[model samples]
Target: MTSPQLENHLPFLRKTGGAWELIVDNKPYLILGAELHNSSMSSARHMESVWGKLRAMNINTVLGNVTWEDIERDEGVFDFTELDRVLVAARSSGLRMILLWFGSFKNGSSSYVPGWVKTNTRRFPRAQIRDEHGSLTLSDSISIFHSECVMADIKAFTELQRHLANFDRQRTVLMVQVQNEVGLLGDSRDRSLQAKKQFNSAVPNDLVRFLSSQFNNLQEDAKEKLGRFQDTLSLCHPSDQRSWEDWFGSSVYTDELFMAYHYATYVESIAAAGKRAYDIPLFTNAWLPKPAVGGGLGNLIAAGGALPGSYPSGGPISNVIDIWHWLAPSLDFVAPDIYDADYTATCDTYKRGGRPLFIPEQRRDAHGARRLWEAIGSHLALGACPFGVDSLEPESFAYTAQYKLLGSLETLILRSRQDSKRTFGFYFDEFEGQQADKGPPIGVSFKEFDLLISRAFVFGRPSPGCGMIIEIHVGRYLIIGDGFKVEFKSRSATSTFTGILRAEEKSVQNTVTGALRTERVLNGDETRSGKWVNMPSENPDYGDGFIPLLTPAGTRIVEAQVYSIDE
Candidate 1:
């Protein structure tokens, strides 16, 4: 038999990449994504229009939710005809899918469950909370204890995965987000008799083991205590507090701890099922805060019950939910579903995990648009996906995307820029913005930085003849613009400083826009001058520049790169 044909695959987003950069065809691939509902248009023809919009925007991944309400409206019965049409349309449009198996919980609600389960008060149970009238209400509509954990939901979802494996396995649809935002949303950890019994049982060996390894030589009281506190490891805090009270203070600690545990269990289980059927990489997306706390947004109160409420004027837990590092060890990668502004801080928080980050969902704001570029060259982000790529207005879509993300990603597409490229990592440098001398030269020693906004203003006003001074280490960092100069010392070649070997200058530009030229100064007069670079490049067209003269204590950059300066 002939070998099976594979379409453009996003193998990087799958299970094997783990915490590192996602590699596709032996290279790390970045995914610019947007999440879409199962049927925004409720028909295949509409999907074609949506896909065209996504392609024009250059979005690479689509997070599509496959709902239980549509698949299994009746128990022991299933329907996938509509979902099949959506997947086929998505594949034809050349966009990959991070399929959300909307099996049980979506933002802590059972609204999507089958009618039989939702209406029945007996077989499928509900979470209980003390209502204002001294009666109990459902903790959340979707519960593993009540609605979702059923074999009914699992079988149908598993079947959905099987269908995708058979049909679109080798196409633009590559990975699956087993579930959407899996977490416990209650006034407290479930207190119902059924939930309490399961909660009281000796904590699972796996978690106990992981916890034991994390805090070795600590008291057993600590282990037992964390279990009692349940949600945020309250055992580490004051002894007098109740688990629910943990909700009121430093909400991140509790929200994140609870989310990480709950989400991990759900993802691992769902991933196991999907892997058994199709062995693809699976992930989950966290609905994050605009100025969120590190753990998770703590505002989801559904039908007067607790759920993941990080959206819509959420309460206390905003700041604490932003900590990506605290939850790093648990999931494949934690994605921030961002909405609102200040894109820089949001992306920065995610990267703190030290794992290669993927912006699975982002705000519709223009600042968020520019940030995609900033993230690519500045932080070495693996992928960036805008939210709702399918629904974006037609007018400025291409203009925003083609330059916003596609421009920077060009380095990874070509055979030459592939291996030579390096992530800029953390830095202390400066540059010019959008005005005359508006762009300025910036420099940073391992200890300090050189910032010269513009020499243009000191003598005259900036005008039509423009210039730029940017300092960066990614996607061909060019310190000066077309008619400028720049110079800096080479790091190290063979475990020692490679002294200044005369600076050479070369202006390189995209084959298309020779007007947008770049000048590189590998080495120059600034080397070993006590300060790496004191005077900015005197070259008129090159703009400003930066030179780093690392101190003796700093580890020499392991390789000696050739030095140059040319026009």
Candidate 2:
């Protein structure tokens, strides 16, 4: 089949060695994005009011939902009125978009399906899950086993893509998420008659062959989870067949694996159909597992249930991520909708085996804002989108300052990402008097210098700070953000000491060119007389004994170079 022709430039992903870049207009583009509330994009007037706020906050891209129910209220009939309005408004605001297709399964519920599909339960069966009692009850989740359900979703999504290609010839819509947090809810696996019948039947020969071939390449954790399946595959003769329970044992993990296979296959079909229609980059997002207390998996917090039904079963979490990757070929990547999870660990897990990392959703708070530096700088992530951006005013949003700094330095940051080792990002969280000694100081070595970064020194208490250090050239580095300090030492065996040669604060002189113009030369107090370079937070606590009541936050970008000396 031939792909649809895109008239103007289309956004695509490119891998440069270890790092991946999002290319827009044939240039490396950093997506400093903000996701609107789920229901906000339905009204064009409401969207018009918030576009200015999003622009003021320095958001280059916006992530919003485009539900199937809204677009296809009647069977075979599709409406693009709201979608067109959103695309036009985003273009007017000079912003790009990633539309989340809230179809088939939305957060483990089929509530977003069209009324016709929802009303006809007999034609399109719902997943059955165990209620509080032992008896089974129908859940709101649509059954993946049914052909009618898959076909309906594929039709709606294909039409959406066709319409996008026609209306958005400018390529304002950069990417599309096939479904929203798709998984089996309220049960580890669907308990309906159709699901049970399939579960008891022989495991699909395609999946069995895939598992047998890719066993060695799968992640260690994945191997351990599917060890039983491997054994079953090895023992079973060509004439013999094994069911899901027979292969993986009757555990919750097995149930999760079964659901993941179906979900991935279903999403793959929809994504493949959409690609045939328009061929824009397509992906899906997962509701990640919350932090586990220890290896034993009991003291997990937030919705941190390790069992299949505890969280959304069959979502593309780390445990089942490899399965989705093997099955969902059409999906460009899988993203995490991070809220209360451990940010660094989650990002690291998602980018396993050279996968592209793009955090589509995260908490919209100061804590979340501080973590973006690590995600983008250290992980080489394409972008980070904090959720519910439209609800907050530009002045109140925690990411406003950080986004502005990143927006201005987009070019420089993209350049630095190529050499992953030379660049390091860090964040110093607020010291709440008790948990002061949590994270250890970060130490890095480059050339003959040892760089030590820790929380900026404060008299009374330390406030939150976040930033990245990019070594533009040998011994020369560009540092951006607030609330951190860099201390340098000599790594040379001969040199006695290493000291900063020059540290200058920089500002963007030309926004279009991303040219950095030095605003002030730092030496005496700012550098503490070559001791360290401090980019203090917006409000630093200098203590009551000091003359100036409170030192305002020093959220400035700086450049520094160092030289070693032997006495």
Candidate 3:
């Protein structure tokens, strides 16, 4: 007989057929999460003032850093005094937490390491990067090759997880990020004497075997990097010795791949130790590649320079993401810390190989807030967190209105996402003049009709817009957010016309029961005389310069039913 349908577990990802949902407290939970400023959580008093502000903005979860230096200042002495206070404050404020471990590396630096570790460079050696003159200079990042450094990090992380498991029976802490934006910054790969020796040695037989066997199935980026060298494993004997330069071309990218192996191994070891202690889901975030400054198509360099050190070498970038996935089996998923890059492309890149999309860090502005809808609606992201959220006031923050609405309708959104094709998220930025530059209107299909959604009709110039749509059933849909409109057209040729039958403004009457009540019936001016449904911008110019007053849409949530007229 089949096993019974499972209920929720403590912060685990549950796969439903093809789609995945984060199960928390016996229900599918959507994290309307915000990440605090990097240094905000260092003090208990600072967190005390921020909790109420976060709740006011309707953020259900907050991602904050838990530094290794602060937790274990004097060698083996682990202290949870400050962390305990932060956790208690979060619990009292009714917010879930995802703690980020700032250890060994944060943006490719060992700045967060304990005072003892920093002082003794011999015991915990720093990574050395080569300069143009071929001389090696020390970077702030710890060397992954150092066993002492790895052991120290592993001990501190294991202790933190153990403490969390015992103290948080309520499981207010949902997930733990292993480290913050880890990788060598100055150079792509470490150029220290020890690193050079390792690089010259034969590539690990296990990695070679895995790469050769899975060559065809690898992600596009990884496949491109491995190129013809991948055939070496199949053509040559396993005992054959092939140095890094022999296996792959002597390029900066090759250096990155080499570093990826070591970094993944180091992170995997730490994550594995933590899992053994507490076994909660663990993830690591990446500082995504910036589009090559002037490099066209194939010549693209993600982090400015052509060498490994230019970007955080060895981080989970697209070129070597597969290596990390294969080597770092202990990590639940790899996330992107997206800022300034092409938003949609970065999201798509991280979601490769059926991995869940989770944005741990992103721009915390209107442009960024608007994109969260797309991340959740289109990508099925577990969460999208805006960086440096503590600095913004609730009333002034761009996410305030959007997050509040999503927070209330989260259950419905989560339920709809199970059927991937039925739900979608979108956003329209302020007009950039060239309409042709903007892509085609978004299209959605129901049995007998298709909906074409575009920027809401404006008498004057259009404004920025963002929102999501869910098809409840054929001919009926739920829409949320503002600054957009949807037009329906009959899919069947036999049907000559299509029109909105009814549009009702909806409000969540009871969140527990998922009961919605109609606050207003929209038609005529509201629905543009049944021509289309409008969810206007929260603040719009009245198109009457004479009147000079902002005309608001008044309501953003709507349920619309459409019908096709047979020819």
Q: Model 3, range 432-549, lDDT digits (tens) per residue?
A: 6666525347887766678888887767666778888888888898988888889999898899888999999999987766678999998877788899888888666556455433
Query: What TM-score would each prediction reach against the true structure?
Result: 0.63, 0.94, 0.93
Task: Extract clashing residue pairs from model 3.
Answer: 186-309, 187-308, 187-309, 188-308, 188-309, 290-302
Clashing pairs in 2: 537-553, 538-553
> Which ten residues in a row are the worst by lDDT in model 3?
294-303
Whichever of 2 and 3 has more lDDT, that candidate is: 2
- Steric clashes per prediction: 43, 2, 6
lDDT of each: 0.46, 0.84, 0.83
Q: What is the lDDT of candidate 3?
A: 0.83
Model 1 worst lDDT window (10 residues): 551-560
Q: Which stretches of candidate 1 lie over 4 Å from their true place?
A: 1-28, 37-42, 130-135, 146-150, 200-202, 216-263, 289-331, 340-356, 402-408, 411-420, 425-567
lDDT of 2: 0.84
- Whose lDDT is greatest here? 2
